[model samples]
Target: MNIAYPYAVSLEEDGVYFVQFRDLEEAFTQGASLEEAAFNAAEVLTGILAYRLDHNQEIPAPSAAQPGERLATPGVEVQSALLLRQARAGRSLSDLANAMQTSWPAVQRLENPHHWPTLKQLDKAARALGKRLVLSLE
Candidate 1:
C-alpha cells in the first residue's frame, strides 16, 4: 500500500502556510512558505507515525487524497516499519521471528522506525508474512 498521507495546506493571514492531515489529527505543522510547509508536513508526519509506533498507538490508514490536497510520505525507514507492522497483523513477534529463522529482537527491529532494515531482510520478513515486497519510485 502507498504510505503517503493526504494533507490540506492553507495560507493564513499571517502569510504562513499551515498543513494538517485529516487522518492524523495530531500531525500538523506550519511553515513560512508553501514549499516549506510541504517539507515540514512530511517531517511531522514521520515523527507522529514514529511516536504512534513506539507507543503502540493506532496508526490510521491514509485516506484518499481529496481535490487540492497533496500527499506527504514519511521517510523510507518509517514506511518500512509501518508496512511490516501492518503485515504482521495480530501475530506475535516471537512467531514471526521463528518463521524468519531470526532472533526475536531482529524481528522486532523490522518494526522499528529508527532501524533501517536491509532490502533482503525486508524481503524475508514479507515472505514470512505471506506477502511480497513491492518497491516504487513515486
Candidate 2:
C-alpha cells in the first residue's frame, strides 16, 4: 500500500487553509497559507497513523486521489510496523511465531499497531521473514 494518502484542501472565510485526508476522517489541520497547510497536513497524517499504530487500530489503505487532492505519508515508525506485517507474505502467523520461538498470539502482537516494538524485536522479525532490517534517517 502507498504510504501517502490523499487530502482535500480548502480555503476558509478567515483566509486560512484547511486540509483533511480523504481516507482518514481523524486527520485534519489548518494553516494561514496553502503551503503551511500542506505542511501541517503531513504532520497531522503522521500523528493519526502513529496513534492508530500505537493503539493497534487498523490503518486504512490510501485512496486514489481525486481532482486537486494532495498526498501525505505516515512516519517511519508506522511504515516499519506495516512493513513487518506485509513481509509475512502468505505465511501464516503461526509460522512466524515458530520461527521466532514464540506463540502465534505473540507474533500477532508484533503486527499489532498498538504493540510498540523495540528495534531488536523488529530486527528479529525481519530475520524471521528472511529479510534484513534497514534504517535510514531522512
Q: Best candidate per lDDT, number?
A: 1
Worst 10 residues of 2 by lDDT: 72-81
Model 2, 48-125: lDDT tens per residue? 887876675777778889989988776666677678766887788888988989888877777665567788888888
Q: What tens-digit string does per-residue lDDT give for candidate 1 at 1-138?
A: 788999999999999999999999989999998899999999999999999999999999999999999999999999999999999989999999999999999999999999999999999999999999999986
Cα shift from native, residue 88, model 1 (Å):
0.9
State the weakest 10-residue window (summed lDDT) of model 1.
129-138
Off by over 4 Å in 1: none
TM-score of each: 0.97, 0.68
TM-score of candidate 2 versus the correct structure, residues matched by position: 0.68
Model 2: per-residue Cα lDDT at residue 45: 84
Alpha-carbon local distance difference test for all models: 0.95, 0.80
The TM-score measured for candidate 1 stands at 0.97
